[model samples]
Target chain A: MESIGIVNYWIVIALMMIALYIVISANNLIKKIIGLNIFQSSVFILYISIGKVGGGTAPILLKEPAVYSNPLPHVLILTAIVVGVATTALGLALIVRIRSAFGTIDDQDVQQDIERN
Target chain B: MIAIELVVNFTLLGFLLVTALYISQTNRLFRAVMLFGIYSLLTASLFVALDAVDVAFTEAAVGTCIATILMLSALSLTGSRKEVRFRRKNATFAVCVSIALGVALAIGIMDMPQFADPNAPANLHVAPYYLQDSYSEIGIPNVVTSVLASYRGYDTLGEVVVIFTAGIGVIALLTARTSKPKED
Candidate 1:
Protein backbone atom coordinates (compact mmCIF):
# COMPACT_ATOMS: atom_id res chain seq x y z
CA MET A 1 0.00 0.00 0.00
CA GLU A 2 2.79 2.40 0.86
CA SER A 3 4.55 1.68 -2.40
CA ILE A 4 1.31 2.07 -4.29
CA GLY A 5 0.82 5.39 -2.62
CA ILE A 6 4.10 6.65 -4.03
CA VAL A 7 3.53 5.48 -7.57
CA ASN A 8 2.86 9.05 -8.62
CA TYR A 9 6.25 10.06 -7.38
CA TRP A 10 7.90 7.36 -9.41
CA ILE A 11 6.12 8.45 -12.53
CA VAL A 12 6.91 12.10 -11.85
CA ILE A 13 10.57 11.21 -11.50
CA ALA A 14 10.53 9.33 -14.76
CA LEU A 15 8.90 12.24 -16.52
CA MET A 16 11.44 14.61 -15.03
CA MET A 17 14.29 12.42 -16.25
CA ILE A 18 12.90 12.25 -19.76
CA ALA A 19 12.49 16.01 -19.87
CA LEU A 20 15.99 16.50 -18.53
CA TYR A 21 17.37 14.24 -21.23
CA ILE A 22 15.59 16.26 -23.87
CA VAL A 23 16.89 19.54 -22.50
CA ILE A 24 20.42 18.21 -22.40
CA SER A 25 20.50 16.42 -25.74
CA ALA A 26 18.21 18.38 -28.05
CA ASN A 27 19.96 20.95 -30.23
CA ASN A 28 16.94 22.95 -31.26
CA LEU A 29 16.32 25.94 -29.03
CA ILE A 30 12.55 25.62 -29.24
CA LYS A 31 12.71 21.92 -28.44
CA LYS A 32 14.91 22.67 -25.46
CA ILE A 33 12.35 25.19 -24.23
CA ILE A 34 9.60 22.58 -24.63
CA GLY A 35 11.70 20.16 -22.61
CA LEU A 36 12.10 22.76 -19.88
CA ASN A 37 8.33 23.20 -19.76
CA ILE A 38 7.90 19.48 -19.34
CA PHE A 39 10.41 19.50 -16.53
CA GLN A 40 8.55 22.35 -14.81
CA SER A 41 5.18 20.60 -15.17
CA SER A 42 6.56 17.38 -13.69
CA VAL A 43 7.85 19.26 -10.67
CA PHE A 44 4.40 20.81 -10.21
CA ILE A 45 2.87 17.34 -10.28
CA LEU A 46 5.26 16.15 -7.60
CA TYR A 47 4.30 19.00 -5.30
CA ILE A 48 0.56 18.43 -5.80
CA SER A 49 1.00 14.71 -5.28
CA ILE A 50 2.66 15.37 -1.95
CA GLY A 51 -0.29 17.47 -0.90
CA LYS A 52 -2.95 14.83 -1.64
CA VAL A 53 -4.92 13.24 1.19
CA GLY A 54 -6.60 9.91 0.61
CA GLY A 55 -10.17 10.93 1.49
CA GLY A 56 -9.87 14.61 0.83
CA THR A 57 -11.78 16.80 -1.56
CA ALA A 58 -10.68 20.01 -3.23
CA PRO A 59 -9.72 22.76 -0.80
CA ILE A 60 -13.05 24.47 -0.87
CA LEU A 61 -15.11 25.02 2.24
CA LEU A 62 -18.41 23.24 2.65
CA LYS A 63 -21.29 23.35 5.13
CA GLU A 64 -20.59 19.80 6.20
CA PRO A 65 -17.23 18.86 7.66
CA ALA A 66 -14.91 17.33 5.09
CA VAL A 67 -11.25 16.55 4.61
CA TYR A 68 -9.43 18.79 2.16
CA SER A 69 -6.19 18.37 0.34
CA ASN A 70 -3.46 20.77 1.42
CA PRO A 71 -4.16 24.15 -0.10
CA LEU A 72 -0.73 25.67 0.45
CA PRO A 73 0.89 23.70 -2.33
CA HIS A 74 -2.00 24.57 -4.57
CA VAL A 75 -1.45 28.27 -3.95
CA LEU A 76 2.27 27.91 -4.47
CA ILE A 77 1.78 26.00 -7.69
CA LEU A 78 -0.79 28.49 -8.92
CA THR A 79 1.89 31.12 -8.78
CA ALA A 80 4.40 28.72 -10.28
CA ILE A 81 2.24 27.82 -13.26
CA VAL A 82 1.80 31.45 -14.20
CA VAL A 83 5.46 32.16 -13.64
CA GLY A 84 6.38 29.15 -15.74
CA VAL A 85 4.44 30.55 -18.68
CA ALA A 86 6.07 33.91 -18.25
CA THR A 87 9.46 32.26 -18.26
CA THR A 88 8.51 30.32 -21.37
CA ALA A 89 7.45 33.46 -23.13
CA LEU A 90 10.68 35.15 -22.22
CA GLY A 91 12.68 32.12 -23.38
CA LEU A 92 10.90 32.05 -26.70
CA ALA A 93 11.52 35.73 -27.14
CA LEU A 94 15.22 35.09 -26.66
CA ILE A 95 15.03 32.24 -29.14
CA VAL A 96 13.56 34.64 -31.68
CA ARG A 97 16.37 37.06 -31.04
CA ILE A 98 18.90 34.26 -31.44
CA ARG A 99 17.30 33.12 -34.65
CA SER A 100 17.52 36.61 -36.11
CA ALA A 101 21.08 37.16 -34.95
CA PHE A 102 22.55 33.83 -36.06
CA GLY A 103 20.06 32.80 -38.79
CA THR A 104 19.84 29.41 -37.09
CA ILE A 105 18.61 27.99 -33.78
CA ASP A 106 20.50 24.72 -33.68
CA ASP A 107 23.01 24.61 -30.82
CA GLN A 108 25.90 23.30 -32.93
CA ASP A 109 25.19 25.64 -35.80
CA VAL A 110 25.14 28.61 -33.54
CA GLN A 111 28.41 27.45 -31.99
CA GLN A 112 30.04 26.91 -35.38
CA ASP A 113 28.92 30.36 -36.52
CA ILE A 114 30.51 31.83 -33.41
CA GLU A 115 33.79 30.03 -34.12
CA ARG A 116 33.84 31.00 -37.77
CA ASN A 117 33.42 34.68 -36.96
CA MET B 1 -13.65 2.93 -4.23
CA ILE B 2 -9.93 3.19 -3.58
CA ALA B 3 -9.36 0.65 -6.34
CA ILE B 4 -10.97 2.90 -8.93
CA GLU B 5 -9.03 5.93 -7.77
CA LEU B 6 -5.81 3.99 -7.96
CA VAL B 7 -6.62 2.73 -11.41
CA VAL B 8 -7.36 6.23 -12.66
CA ASN B 9 -4.20 7.59 -11.12
CA PHE B 10 -2.07 4.85 -12.59
CA THR B 11 -3.62 5.14 -16.03
CA LEU B 12 -3.21 8.89 -16.18
CA LEU B 13 0.34 8.71 -14.95
CA GLY B 14 1.17 6.00 -17.47
CA PHE B 15 -0.13 8.20 -20.25
CA LEU B 16 1.90 11.12 -18.96
CA LEU B 17 5.04 9.02 -18.96
CA VAL B 18 4.49 7.80 -22.49
CA THR B 19 3.77 11.31 -23.75
CA ALA B 20 6.92 12.66 -22.15
CA LEU B 21 8.91 9.91 -23.84
CA TYR B 22 7.33 10.69 -27.18
CA ILE B 23 8.08 14.39 -26.79
CA SER B 24 11.69 13.64 -26.00
CA GLN B 25 12.23 11.37 -29.01
CA THR B 26 10.47 13.41 -31.69
CA ASN B 27 12.65 15.58 -33.94
CA ARG B 28 9.85 17.59 -35.51
CA LEU B 29 9.70 20.83 -33.56
CA PHE B 30 6.03 21.38 -34.42
CA ARG B 31 5.05 17.84 -33.47
CA ALA B 32 6.89 18.11 -30.18
CA VAL B 33 5.17 21.42 -29.40
CA MET B 34 1.72 19.95 -30.14
CA LEU B 35 2.43 16.87 -28.04
CA PHE B 36 3.67 19.11 -25.23
CA GLY B 37 0.23 20.73 -25.17
CA ILE B 38 -1.28 17.28 -24.77
CA TYR B 39 1.18 16.61 -21.98
CA SER B 40 0.05 19.72 -20.13
CA LEU B 41 -3.62 18.73 -20.48
CA LEU B 42 -2.86 15.32 -19.01
CA THR B 43 -0.96 16.95 -16.17
CA ALA B 44 -3.92 19.19 -15.41
CA SER B 45 -6.16 16.13 -15.33
CA LEU B 46 -3.78 14.49 -12.90
CA PHE B 47 -3.93 17.61 -10.73
CA VAL B 48 -7.72 17.28 -10.70
CA ALA B 49 -7.43 13.66 -9.58
CA LEU B 50 -5.10 14.77 -6.80
CA ASP B 51 -7.86 17.04 -5.41
CA ALA B 52 -6.15 20.25 -6.47
CA VAL B 53 -8.94 21.76 -8.51
CA ASP B 54 -7.59 25.29 -8.33
CA VAL B 55 -4.16 24.18 -9.41
CA ALA B 56 -5.68 22.08 -12.17
CA PHE B 57 -7.63 25.09 -13.42
CA THR B 58 -4.54 27.26 -13.54
CA GLU B 59 -2.48 24.51 -15.16
CA ALA B 60 -5.11 24.04 -17.83
CA ALA B 61 -5.33 27.75 -18.55
CA VAL B 62 -1.66 28.63 -18.35
CA GLY B 63 0.00 25.44 -19.46
CA THR B 64 -2.34 24.23 -22.18
CA CYS B 65 -3.65 27.59 -23.30
CA ILE B 66 -1.05 30.34 -22.81
CA ALA B 67 2.10 28.25 -23.04
CA THR B 68 0.98 26.43 -26.19
CA ILE B 69 -0.02 29.67 -27.87
CA LEU B 70 3.26 31.29 -26.94
CA MET B 71 5.27 28.29 -28.17
CA LEU B 72 3.40 28.22 -31.45
CA SER B 73 3.97 31.93 -31.91
CA ALA B 74 7.64 31.44 -31.12
CA LEU B 75 7.78 28.62 -33.64
CA SER B 76 6.38 30.91 -36.28
CA LEU B 77 8.75 33.76 -35.45
CA THR B 78 11.84 31.57 -35.31
CA GLY B 79 10.76 29.88 -38.59
CA SER B 80 12.64 26.65 -37.83
CA ARG B 81 10.06 24.06 -38.77
CA LYS B 82 12.31 21.02 -38.39
CA GLU B 83 15.18 20.17 -36.04
CA VAL B 84 18.55 19.08 -37.39
CA ARG B 85 18.68 15.28 -37.72
CA PHE B 86 22.29 14.74 -36.76
CA ARG B 87 22.87 11.92 -34.27
CA ARG B 88 23.74 13.08 -30.77
CA LYS B 89 27.22 11.85 -30.07
CA ASN B 90 26.81 12.54 -26.36
CA ALA B 91 23.46 10.82 -26.12
CA THR B 92 24.93 7.94 -24.13
CA PHE B 93 26.49 10.33 -21.63
CA ALA B 94 23.23 12.23 -21.22
CA VAL B 95 21.27 9.01 -20.64
CA CYS B 96 23.76 7.75 -18.08
CA VAL B 97 23.61 11.06 -16.19
CA SER B 98 19.80 11.09 -16.21
CA ILE B 99 19.57 7.49 -14.99
CA ALA B 100 22.12 8.06 -12.25
CA LEU B 101 20.35 11.15 -10.96
CA GLY B 102 16.97 9.46 -11.25
CA VAL B 103 18.08 6.46 -9.21
CA ALA B 104 19.48 8.68 -6.50
CA LEU B 105 16.25 10.66 -6.36
CA ALA B 106 14.23 7.44 -6.21
CA ILE B 107 16.27 6.30 -3.25
CA GLY B 108 15.57 9.61 -1.55
CA ILE B 109 11.87 9.21 -2.30
CA MET B 110 11.86 5.93 -0.40
CA ASP B 111 12.16 7.87 2.82
CA MET B 112 9.27 10.18 2.06
CA PRO B 113 6.01 9.71 3.94
CA GLN B 114 3.48 7.59 2.11
CA PHE B 115 1.35 9.59 -0.29
CA ALA B 116 -1.87 11.01 1.16
CA ASP B 117 -0.79 10.19 4.67
CA PRO B 118 -2.68 12.65 6.87
CA ASN B 119 0.12 13.02 9.39
CA ALA B 120 2.78 13.73 6.83
CA PRO B 121 4.97 16.66 7.94
CA ALA B 122 3.98 18.66 4.90
CA ASN B 123 0.37 18.31 5.97
CA LEU B 124 1.19 19.28 9.55
CA HIS B 125 3.25 22.43 9.12
CA VAL B 126 0.94 25.48 8.88
CA ALA B 127 -1.33 23.78 6.36
CA PRO B 128 -3.78 22.72 9.00
CA TYR B 129 -4.06 26.28 10.27
CA TYR B 130 -4.81 27.67 6.80
CA LEU B 131 -7.22 24.82 6.10
CA GLN B 132 -9.05 25.18 9.37
CA ASP B 133 -9.06 28.93 9.89
CA SER B 134 -8.95 30.53 6.45
CA TYR B 135 -12.68 30.19 5.99
CA SER B 136 -13.49 31.81 9.30
CA GLU B 137 -10.86 34.51 9.10
CA ILE B 138 -11.06 35.40 5.43
CA GLY B 139 -14.76 34.60 4.81
CA ILE B 140 -13.92 32.89 1.57
CA PRO B 141 -15.31 29.49 0.64
CA ASN B 142 -12.19 28.57 -1.21
CA VAL B 143 -9.27 27.97 1.09
CA VAL B 144 -6.76 28.36 -1.71
CA THR B 145 -8.02 31.80 -2.62
CA SER B 146 -8.09 32.89 1.01
CA VAL B 147 -4.56 31.73 1.55
CA LEU B 148 -3.36 33.08 -1.75
CA ALA B 149 -5.12 36.40 -1.59
CA SER B 150 -5.03 37.03 2.16
CA TYR B 151 -2.39 34.99 3.90
CA ARG B 152 0.16 34.97 1.11
CA GLY B 153 -0.73 38.25 -0.56
CA TYR B 154 2.84 39.49 -0.64
CA ASP B 155 4.04 36.38 -2.41
CA THR B 156 1.41 36.82 -5.04
CA LEU B 157 2.41 40.45 -5.36
CA GLY B 158 5.97 39.36 -5.87
CA GLU B 159 4.84 36.86 -8.48
CA VAL B 160 3.01 39.64 -10.28
CA VAL B 161 6.15 41.76 -10.32
CA VAL B 162 8.15 38.84 -11.66
CA ILE B 163 5.60 38.41 -14.40
CA PHE B 164 5.63 42.12 -15.16
CA THR B 165 9.39 42.06 -15.42
CA ALA B 166 9.25 39.06 -17.73
CA GLY B 167 6.76 40.87 -19.93
CA ILE B 168 9.06 43.87 -20.15
CA GLY B 169 11.98 41.61 -20.93
CA VAL B 170 10.09 39.88 -23.72
CA ILE B 171 9.02 43.20 -25.24
CA ALA B 172 12.55 44.54 -25.07
CA LEU B 173 14.05 41.40 -26.60
CA LEU B 174 11.51 40.98 -29.36
CA THR B 175 11.38 44.65 -30.41
CA ALA B 176 15.10 45.41 -30.44
CA ARG B 177 16.62 46.12 -33.87
CA THR B 178 18.33 43.11 -35.44
CA SER B 179 19.81 44.97 -38.42
CA LYS B 180 23.38 44.12 -39.41
CA PRO B 181 26.09 46.46 -38.27
CA LYS B 182 27.27 49.08 -40.83
CA GLU B 183 30.99 49.38 -41.61
CA ASP B 184 32.38 52.68 -40.38
Candidate 2:
Protein backbone atom coordinates (compact mmCIF):
# COMPACT_ATOMS: atom_id res chain seq x y z
CA MET A 1 0.00 0.00 0.00
CA GLU A 2 2.81 2.38 0.84
CA SER A 3 6.19 2.92 -0.82
CA ILE A 4 8.74 0.53 0.67
CA GLY A 5 11.40 2.15 2.86
CA ILE A 6 13.51 -0.97 3.36
CA VAL A 7 15.47 -2.62 0.56
CA ASN A 8 16.99 -5.55 2.50
CA TYR A 9 14.14 -7.92 1.70
CA TRP A 10 14.30 -7.18 -2.00
CA ILE A 11 18.02 -7.79 -2.08
CA VAL A 12 17.50 -11.11 -0.33
CA ILE A 13 14.81 -12.03 -2.81
CA ALA A 14 17.15 -11.32 -5.70
CA LEU A 15 19.79 -13.49 -4.09
CA MET A 16 17.22 -16.26 -3.73
CA MET A 17 16.45 -16.14 -7.42
CA ILE A 18 20.09 -16.24 -8.34
CA ALA A 19 20.69 -19.20 -6.07
CA LEU A 20 17.73 -21.10 -7.50
CA TYR A 21 18.79 -20.40 -11.03
CA ILE A 22 22.27 -21.70 -10.27
CA VAL A 23 20.91 -24.87 -8.71
CA ILE A 24 18.68 -25.58 -11.70
CA SER A 25 21.22 -24.66 -14.35
CA ALA A 26 24.63 -25.72 -13.05
CA ASN A 27 25.98 -28.96 -14.48
CA ASN A 28 28.43 -29.77 -11.72
CA LEU A 29 27.12 -31.35 -8.55
CA ILE A 30 29.48 -29.31 -6.42
CA LYS A 31 28.17 -26.13 -8.01
CA LYS A 32 24.66 -27.26 -7.24
CA ILE A 33 25.59 -27.74 -3.56
CA ILE A 34 27.07 -24.25 -3.50
CA GLY A 35 23.85 -22.91 -5.00
CA LEU A 36 21.84 -24.67 -2.36
CA ASN A 37 24.02 -23.09 0.32
CA ILE A 38 23.38 -19.68 -1.17
CA PHE A 39 19.66 -20.36 -1.22
CA GLN A 40 19.66 -21.36 2.46
CA SER A 41 21.82 -18.38 3.40
CA SER A 42 19.43 -16.00 1.66
CA VAL A 43 16.57 -17.47 3.63
CA PHE A 44 18.56 -16.85 6.85
CA ILE A 45 19.16 -13.24 5.83
CA LEU A 46 15.45 -12.80 5.17
CA TYR A 47 14.55 -14.12 8.61
CA ILE A 48 17.19 -12.07 10.41
CA SER A 49 16.11 -8.92 8.59
CA ILE A 50 12.53 -9.52 9.69
CA GLY A 51 13.63 -9.84 13.32
CA LYS A 52 15.41 -6.52 13.40
CA VAL A 53 13.97 -3.62 15.44
CA GLY A 54 14.52 -0.02 14.35
CA GLY A 55 16.86 0.94 17.19
CA GLY A 56 17.62 -2.44 18.68
CA THR A 57 21.03 -3.73 19.56
CA ALA A 58 21.93 -7.44 19.77
CA PRO A 59 19.62 -9.45 22.00
CA ILE A 60 22.16 -9.84 24.79
CA LEU A 61 20.72 -8.00 27.79
CA LEU A 62 22.68 -4.95 28.85
CA LYS A 63 22.00 -1.86 30.98
CA GLU A 64 22.39 0.66 28.17
CA PRO A 65 19.34 0.71 25.87
CA ALA A 66 16.37 -1.57 26.33
CA VAL A 67 15.67 -2.17 22.62
CA TYR A 68 16.80 -5.58 21.34
CA SER A 69 16.36 -7.50 18.12
CA ASN A 70 14.10 -10.56 18.03
CA PRO A 71 15.83 -13.64 19.43
CA LEU A 72 13.48 -16.26 18.02
CA PRO A 73 14.66 -16.01 14.42
CA HIS A 74 18.28 -15.99 15.50
CA VAL A 75 17.76 -19.16 17.49
CA LEU A 76 15.85 -20.84 14.69
CA ILE A 77 18.49 -19.92 12.14
CA LEU A 78 21.25 -21.29 14.36
CA THR A 79 19.69 -24.71 14.17
CA ALA A 80 19.09 -24.32 10.45
CA ILE A 81 22.74 -23.40 9.80
CA VAL A 82 24.01 -26.45 11.67
CA VAL A 83 21.55 -28.67 9.84
CA GLY A 84 22.58 -27.08 6.56
CA VAL A 85 26.22 -27.97 7.15
CA ALA A 86 25.36 -31.54 8.04
CA THR A 87 23.28 -31.85 4.90
CA THR A 88 26.06 -30.35 2.81
CA ALA A 89 28.56 -32.81 4.23
CA LEU A 90 26.28 -35.71 3.43
CA GLY A 91 25.66 -34.42 -0.09
CA LEU A 92 29.37 -34.07 -0.79
CA ALA A 93 30.04 -37.56 0.47
CA LEU A 94 27.44 -38.88 -1.92
CA ILE A 95 29.05 -36.97 -4.74
CA VAL A 96 32.41 -38.53 -3.97
CA ARG A 97 30.88 -41.99 -4.04
CA ILE A 98 29.18 -41.24 -7.32
CA ARG A 99 32.44 -40.10 -8.88
CA SER A 100 34.21 -43.22 -7.66
CA ALA A 101 31.54 -45.56 -8.91
CA PHE A 102 30.88 -44.03 -12.31
CA GLY A 103 34.41 -42.65 -12.99
CA THR A 104 32.81 -39.43 -14.13
CA ILE A 105 31.25 -36.48 -12.31
CA ASP A 106 29.32 -34.82 -15.12
CA ASP A 107 25.59 -35.24 -14.71
CA GLN A 108 24.94 -36.05 -18.36
CA ASP A 109 27.67 -38.64 -18.49
CA VAL A 110 26.53 -40.21 -15.26
CA GLN A 111 23.01 -40.46 -16.57
CA GLN A 112 24.17 -42.02 -19.81
CA ASP A 113 26.28 -44.54 -17.93
CA ILE A 114 23.36 -45.51 -15.75
CA GLU A 115 21.06 -45.91 -18.72
CA ARG A 116 23.59 -48.02 -20.54
CA ASN A 117 24.16 -50.22 -17.49
CA MET B 1 24.31 8.23 10.31
CA ILE B 2 21.28 6.63 8.71
CA ALA B 3 22.76 7.39 5.29
CA ILE B 4 25.92 5.53 6.27
CA GLU B 5 23.89 2.51 7.34
CA LEU B 6 21.99 2.56 4.10
CA VAL B 7 25.21 2.75 2.10
CA VAL B 8 26.80 -0.12 3.99
CA ASN B 9 23.66 -2.20 3.57
CA PHE B 10 23.48 -1.69 -0.17
CA THR B 11 27.19 -2.19 -0.64
CA LEU B 12 27.16 -5.53 1.18
CA LEU B 13 24.14 -6.58 -0.86
CA GLY B 14 25.86 -5.46 -4.04
CA PHE B 15 28.85 -7.60 -3.13
CA LEU B 16 26.54 -10.53 -2.45
CA LEU B 17 24.94 -10.23 -5.87
CA VAL B 18 28.27 -9.93 -7.60
CA THR B 19 29.65 -12.98 -5.76
CA ALA B 20 26.55 -15.03 -6.56
CA LEU B 21 26.84 -14.12 -10.23
CA TYR B 22 30.48 -15.13 -10.28
CA ILE B 23 29.77 -18.39 -8.49
CA SER B 24 26.99 -19.27 -10.92
CA GLN B 25 28.98 -18.42 -14.03
CA THR B 26 32.44 -19.57 -13.12
CA ASN B 27 33.63 -22.71 -14.93
CA ARG B 28 36.26 -23.51 -12.34
CA LEU B 29 34.80 -25.33 -9.39
CA PHE B 30 37.63 -24.15 -7.12
CA ARG B 31 37.04 -20.52 -7.98
CA ALA B 32 33.32 -20.90 -7.38
CA VAL B 33 33.99 -22.41 -3.97
CA MET B 34 36.20 -19.47 -3.08
CA LEU B 35 33.52 -17.02 -4.20
CA PHE B 36 30.92 -18.89 -2.20
CA GLY B 37 33.13 -18.47 0.88
CA ILE B 38 33.25 -14.75 0.26
CA TYR B 39 29.48 -14.68 -0.15
CA SER B 40 29.06 -16.29 3.28
CA LEU B 41 31.41 -13.75 4.86
CA LEU B 42 29.44 -10.89 3.34
CA THR B 43 26.17 -12.32 4.65
CA ALA B 44 27.76 -12.56 8.11
CA SER B 45 28.49 -8.85 8.02
CA LEU B 46 24.95 -8.19 6.90
CA PHE B 47 23.67 -10.18 9.86
CA VAL B 48 25.77 -8.04 12.21
CA ALA B 49 24.27 -4.90 10.69
CA LEU B 50 20.83 -6.28 11.44
CA ASP B 51 21.84 -6.81 15.10
CA ALA B 52 21.80 -10.57 14.67
CA VAL B 53 25.15 -11.18 16.26
CA ASP B 54 24.41 -14.81 17.10
CA VAL B 55 23.31 -15.55 13.57
CA ALA B 56 26.43 -13.86 12.24
CA PHE B 57 28.62 -15.98 14.50
CA THR B 58 27.00 -19.20 13.35
CA GLU B 59 27.13 -18.12 9.74
CA ALA B 60 30.81 -17.43 10.00
CA ALA B 61 31.47 -20.75 11.70
CA VAL B 62 29.30 -23.08 9.63
CA GLY B 63 29.01 -21.40 6.26
CA THR B 64 32.59 -20.26 5.92
CA CYS B 65 34.50 -23.00 7.70
CA ILE B 66 32.55 -26.23 7.49
CA ALA B 67 30.82 -25.83 4.14
CA THR B 68 33.94 -24.65 2.33
CA ILE B 69 36.12 -27.43 3.70
CA LEU B 70 33.54 -30.09 2.90
CA MET B 71 33.18 -28.75 -0.62
CA LEU B 72 36.91 -28.65 -1.21
CA SER B 73 37.24 -32.25 -0.05
CA ALA B 74 34.46 -33.24 -2.43
CA LEU B 75 36.17 -31.31 -5.20
CA SER B 76 39.40 -33.16 -4.58
CA LEU B 77 37.55 -36.38 -5.20
CA THR B 78 35.82 -35.08 -8.31
CA GLY B 79 37.41 -33.02 -11.06
CA SER B 80 37.81 -29.28 -10.56
CA ARG B 81 36.54 -28.28 -14.01
CA LYS B 82 32.85 -28.05 -14.79
CA GLU B 83 31.33 -29.45 -17.94
CA VAL B 84 31.59 -27.37 -21.09
CA ARG B 85 28.17 -25.72 -20.65
CA PHE B 86 24.65 -26.35 -19.53
CA ARG B 87 22.20 -27.55 -22.13
CA ARG B 88 20.40 -24.61 -23.71
CA LYS B 89 16.97 -25.95 -22.78
CA ASN B 90 17.88 -26.36 -19.10
CA ALA B 91 19.36 -22.86 -18.87
CA THR B 92 16.30 -21.29 -20.49
CA PHE B 93 13.94 -23.22 -18.26
CA ALA B 94 15.89 -22.33 -15.14
CA VAL B 95 15.84 -18.64 -16.05
CA CYS B 96 12.11 -18.71 -16.66
CA VAL B 97 11.33 -20.47 -13.41
CA SER B 98 13.59 -18.19 -11.39
CA ILE B 99 12.01 -15.08 -12.93
CA ALA B 100 8.51 -16.34 -12.24
CA LEU B 101 9.29 -17.22 -8.64
CA GLY B 102 11.09 -13.91 -8.08
CA VAL B 103 8.14 -11.92 -9.39
CA ALA B 104 5.66 -13.81 -7.21
CA LEU B 105 7.78 -13.34 -4.08
CA ALA B 106 8.40 -9.65 -4.78
CA ILE B 107 4.68 -9.07 -5.15
CA GLY B 108 3.98 -10.92 -1.89
CA ILE B 109 6.60 -8.76 -0.19
CA MET B 110 4.69 -5.63 -1.07
CA ASP B 111 2.29 -6.12 1.87
CA MET B 112 4.99 -7.00 4.42
CA PRO B 113 6.10 -4.51 7.03
CA GLN B 114 9.11 -2.28 6.43
CA PHE B 115 12.46 -3.37 7.83
CA ALA B 116 12.98 -2.97 11.60
CA ASP B 117 9.42 -1.85 12.38
CA PRO B 118 9.00 -2.69 16.06
CA ASN B 119 5.24 -3.01 15.75
CA ALA B 120 5.35 -5.50 12.88
CA PRO B 121 3.37 -8.68 13.45
CA ALA B 122 6.49 -10.80 13.95
CA ASN B 123 7.84 -8.42 16.54
CA LEU B 124 4.51 -8.14 18.34
CA HIS B 125 3.58 -11.82 18.62
CA VAL B 126 5.65 -14.14 20.88
CA ALA B 127 8.90 -12.19 20.50
CA PRO B 128 7.98 -9.55 23.10
CA TYR B 129 7.06 -12.29 25.53
CA TYR B 130 10.39 -13.96 25.02
CA LEU B 131 12.21 -10.70 25.57
CA GLN B 132 10.18 -9.68 28.63
CA ASP B 133 10.15 -12.94 30.53
CA SER B 134 13.28 -14.73 29.31
CA TYR B 135 15.54 -13.41 32.03
CA SER B 136 13.11 -14.21 34.84
CA GLU B 137 12.09 -17.59 33.44
CA ILE B 138 15.44 -18.91 32.30
CA GLY B 139 17.67 -16.79 34.53
CA ILE B 140 19.87 -16.09 31.50
CA PRO B 141 20.89 -12.79 29.97
CA ASN B 142 21.07 -14.18 26.41
CA VAL B 143 17.51 -14.47 25.20
CA VAL B 144 18.43 -16.45 22.12
CA THR B 145 20.17 -19.14 24.10
CA SER B 146 17.43 -19.20 26.74
CA VAL B 147 14.68 -19.52 24.20
CA LEU B 148 16.57 -22.04 22.07
CA ALA B 149 17.66 -24.41 24.81
CA SER B 150 14.88 -23.90 27.35
CA TYR B 151 11.56 -22.86 25.83
CA ARG B 152 12.20 -24.77 22.60
CA GLY B 153 14.09 -27.75 23.96
CA TYR B 154 12.34 -30.28 21.78
CA ASP B 155 13.22 -28.42 18.61
CA THR B 156 16.88 -28.24 19.58
CA LEU B 157 16.89 -31.94 20.47
CA GLY B 158 15.44 -32.76 17.08
CA GLU B 159 18.12 -30.66 15.40
CA VAL B 160 20.86 -32.55 17.24
CA VAL B 161 19.39 -35.87 16.14
CA VAL B 162 19.25 -34.66 12.56
CA ILE B 163 22.91 -33.69 12.64
CA PHE B 164 23.82 -37.05 14.11
CA THR B 165 21.86 -38.88 11.43
CA ALA B 166 23.65 -36.89 8.76
CA GLY B 167 27.05 -37.86 10.13
CA ILE B 168 26.01 -41.50 10.15
CA GLY B 169 24.74 -41.18 6.62
CA VAL B 170 28.03 -39.74 5.41
CA ILE B 171 29.96 -42.54 7.06
CA ALA B 172 27.70 -45.16 5.52
CA LEU B 173 28.00 -43.68 2.07
CA LEU B 174 31.78 -43.31 2.08
CA THR B 175 32.83 -46.52 3.78
CA ALA B 176 33.68 -49.67 1.84
CA ARG B 177 31.79 -52.93 2.01
CA THR B 178 34.77 -55.17 2.63
CA SER B 179 36.21 -55.19 6.13
CA LYS B 180 39.73 -56.27 5.21
CA PRO B 181 42.53 -53.75 4.89
CA LYS B 182 45.99 -54.28 3.40
CA GLU B 183 48.94 -54.14 5.83
CA ASP B 184 50.91 -50.91 5.57
- TM-score per candidate, chains pooled: 0.96, 0.93
lDDT over C-alpha atoms for residue A26 of model 2: 82
Worst 10 residues of 1 chain B by lDDT: B175-184
Model 1 chain A worst lDDT window (10 residues): A1-10
TM-score of chain B of 2: 0.91
CAPRI band for model 2: medium
Tell me the whole-model lDDT of each prediction, alpha carbons only: 0.88, 0.86
The regions of model 2 sitting more than 4 angstroms off are A1-4, B81-84, B178-184
lDDT of 1 by residue, B1-184 (tens): 6567677788899999999999888889899989999999999998988999999899998899999999999989978776646456757777987898799989989988898888899999999999888877999999999999999999999999999999999999989988762222
Error in Å for residue B106 of model 1: 1.5
Model 2: per-residue Cα lDDT over B81-110, one tens digit each:
654466778889999999998999999899
Instruction: Report how far off residue A8 is in candidate 2 (Å).
Output: 1.5
TM-score of chain A of each: 0.96, 0.93
How far in Å is the alpha carbon of B4 misplaced in model 2?
2.8
Interface RMSD of each: 2.0, 4.0
